[model samples]
Target: MTFTPHILESALLLLATFLIGCAIGFVLRRFLAKPSKLVSTKAEAPVGAKPQKKVAAASPTKAAPAKKGARPAARKQTPPQSDSAESQAIDAGTEEDDLKKISGIGPKLENELKASGILTYAQIAGWSARTIDEMDAKLNARGRIKRDDWVRQAKALNKAKASA
Candidate 1:
């Protein structure tokens, strides 16, 4: 077959039509699409809510006292408690509840608590607000104690243990 002006004109018209069709399809797809709920919705704090900070758990070991003329390394502070409830020392080597039984506490958190000398529900039940805040901070739970109401759960668990 020989190339001719008529065939060339027909081929060019067909290519132009195809390109125009693609452009229209693209525009329609973009303009007519509805937003997907899953893709569009994002987790955002409500306006006017206070922002919260999360810290990672600190090492359980205590450091030696700093020598004079040396700056001490910044350490995670153990919360000071004026209340007598937590003034009693946490008992070690005693039979203890599986702290993982509490919601939001995993085996890692349970081990962390045990390492910190918190082996029993009785000890948790005796925590003052300061102690709770300290423990929450130490665990890096990011307000989980307050959110999960662990103190209430601990008190109930302690009472239950007493009876059983």
Candidate 2:
């Protein structure tokens, strides 16, 4: 084939365009990618690593000064009676029930429940209508608790445990 300057120029331009595009992609991948922090509160420690005890801070630190146009840092609202009181009840030597035994609760849901301080069938059994709504919202259950009748199951389970 005869070497035509027009075809050669077109091929050269295409190659140059491809190389520029690849260089831009490499730069973007290197500089724009960010490492995300884990959203889960309970992260598993590495194997053979000793668990660190959490030391309570003597006093709360003051909030940092906010910049103009910057939104305030979101504060985690403490759950009312459900979390605090239930955790206290567990701390008082109440044996934690196998929450997974209840219908519709799996290992993941049980972990979420435990994270929210739900430790006993008694706690699930004693949920009021308002508390159920609160828990549904907290767990993002969207009425699963009510639909699954976890309270009824918990009551029966607790009673069975008592009898045995």
Candidate 3:
């Protein structure tokens, strides 16, 4: 039932044979085998081979200038005309110090107000409830009427103008 030297010798011999087989397999894989089909067909380009030059594109020819007899196209650069009656009215007001001096009044509004016949501070101060209502209606119809407080501002501006 005890272990014997012969069994140990047999085990050592099997181990040595297995190691030799592995070494032989490693040597075959490294040197003796053919290259894979995926690799064997593709060859590296020669280092001294000349690279192909890319062709430059030809430049496009310019068109000849138009003849002198031809009429030049007229540029239509008219300033935008407001169709809004209130804006037109506001724009027509005078260049007076009081009318133009109002904070929100601009050149266009001044012109419109002038066109509407609201020319002076006295005219603004003289505006009756009916006149204001009418102006308001015209302004509202135009859709470009300013803030509702414009009348008050205009009135104040007119008062300031009169006192000065």
Candidate 4:
């Protein structure tokens, strides 16, 4: 089939219009999307190290203007006493375990767990159902601990560590 100039021009115009529409849609979505409030400002502490407490600065009566498209500053809150108690129970000068040994735990997950003060296999082995649920929400694991049978694995690993 022979191509006509009119057909070629129409196809080019349609493609140009589609490209421009896509660009506009992308820009609109980028600027109009709501910012997430779960931004974490705390730096990750090394495994087995105690997490530092953050001191809150007094807020001014007037708020400063935020830059367009910049994320809002993360608000700092005092950590629950239960978290510190849990950490203290497991810590006790014990060396940190490699949590990645547990099924479904990777480097990222291990780091997150360490940041939350879960540093030893004993801790994972000791979690009850309620503790697991609290961890699920805290780590955003969505029942991954139960799904992966992390408790059983942790028990075995802890036993092996103890034996060795």
Best lDDT among the predictions, by candidate number: 4
Predicted candidate 2 versus true structure: per-residue lDDT over 1-164, tens digit per residue? 66798899999999999999999999998999896776988855422234588997765477566799998779999775433223334565677899999998999889988877789998888887877777777678888999999999999999999999
Model 1 Cα lDDT, one tens digit per residue, 53-136: 898787768757668899867998898644433244565557778888777889999998876667788777777787777778
Candidate with the larger TM-score of 1 and 2: 2
The global Cα lDDT (0 to 1) of model 1 is 0.76
How well is each residue in 56-130 modelled by candidate 4, as lDDT tens digits? 896887778789899977998987545331443563678899999999999988998887778999888887776
Least well predicted 10-residue stretch by lDDT in candidate 2: 80-89
Instruction: Tell me how far candidate 4 lies from the true structure as C-alpha RMSD in angstroms.
Output: 16.5
lDDT of 4 at 23: 99
Cand. 4 Cα-lDDT: 0.81
Assess the local accuracy of residue 111 in candidate 2 as a C-alpha lDDT between 0 and 100. Answer: 95
Please list the residue runs of candidate 1 whose C-alpha ends up more than 4 Å from where it truly belongs after superposition: 1-88
RMSD of 2: 16.6
Q: Following a full C-alpha superposition, what root-mean-square deviation does model 3 have from the true structure? A: 30.1
lDDT ranking, best first: 4, 2, 1, 3
* 135: Cα error in model 4, Å: 0.4
lDDT by residue (tens digit), candidate 3, 28-53: 99898998767566653422224588
Give the TM-score (vs. native) of candidate 2: 0.49
Better of 2 and 4 by TM-score: 4
Total clashing residue pairs per candidate? Answer: 0, 0, 21, 0
Query: Which candidate has the highest TM-score of all?
Result: 4
